[model samples]
Target: MKIPVIGRRDDTADTPDHPATDPIEELRAQLRRVCGGRLRTLDAEREHLDARRRGEAARMRRVGE
Candidate 1:
């Protein structure tokens, strides 16, 4: 004798009318947006510091000569 299971549905099934969105992908996209902004800010700050360092080096070289 076979017994049918009730209140059970397949979560991975997708229909043509509506597509299922993966929660993992959504979280990854949000993380990328946040990390991308932080990376850009850090890059700008590094460039500014490098420029200042170069200016100081040039001044030291002129003083030594």
Candidate 2:
């Protein structure tokens, strides 16, 4: 299951109070990157999420801890 929406703590850095990239523009850019000329918002989101999951999993792995 996916995470629930929750308020962020002050220490978070991933998002600014106001993000520079417009969501629609970012999605369009991702679509263009993934597909040569077609729309692919789902593909973009999936790729982004998979990459983040991989990074987080690697970060959480126990390595001589």
Candidate 3:
């Protein structure tokens, strides 16, 4: 008895239209996206906290006067 092939027989599977990709690069790109989002959130939070601190300081000065 003869067995039949089950998968692609030519190297055209990795054609120019669908080139192969590096796993490490893909992970790095994903990490950059996540870190960028987190950085933006942290920056916004810092700005908000700084504003609150300044307001509180101003209120304290008024009380002292």
Candidate models: Cα lDDT each = 0.60, 0.59, 0.61
Model 2 TM-score is: 0.34
Specify the highest-lDDT model's number: 3
lDDT of 3 by residue, 29-49 (tens): 556676883433578879989
What lDDT score is found at residue 19 in candidate 2?
41
- Point out the higher-scoring one by lDDT: 2 or 3: 3
Model 2 sits at a Cα RMSD from the real structure of 16.7
Question: 1-65, model 1: which lDDT tens digit per residue?
Answer: 22212333245336664345465554555566768834335788799899999999999999999
Clashes of each: 0, 0, 0
For model 2, the superposed segments whose C-alpha errors exceed 4 Å read 1-40, 62-64
Q: For all the candidates, what are their Cα RMSDs to the real structure?
A: 13.2, 16.7, 12.5
Q: Candidate 3 clashing pairs?
A: none
Give the candidates in order of TM-score, highest first.
Answer: 3, 1, 2
Q: Which pairs, if any, clash in model 2?
A: none
Candidate 1: where are CA atoms >4 Å away?
1-40
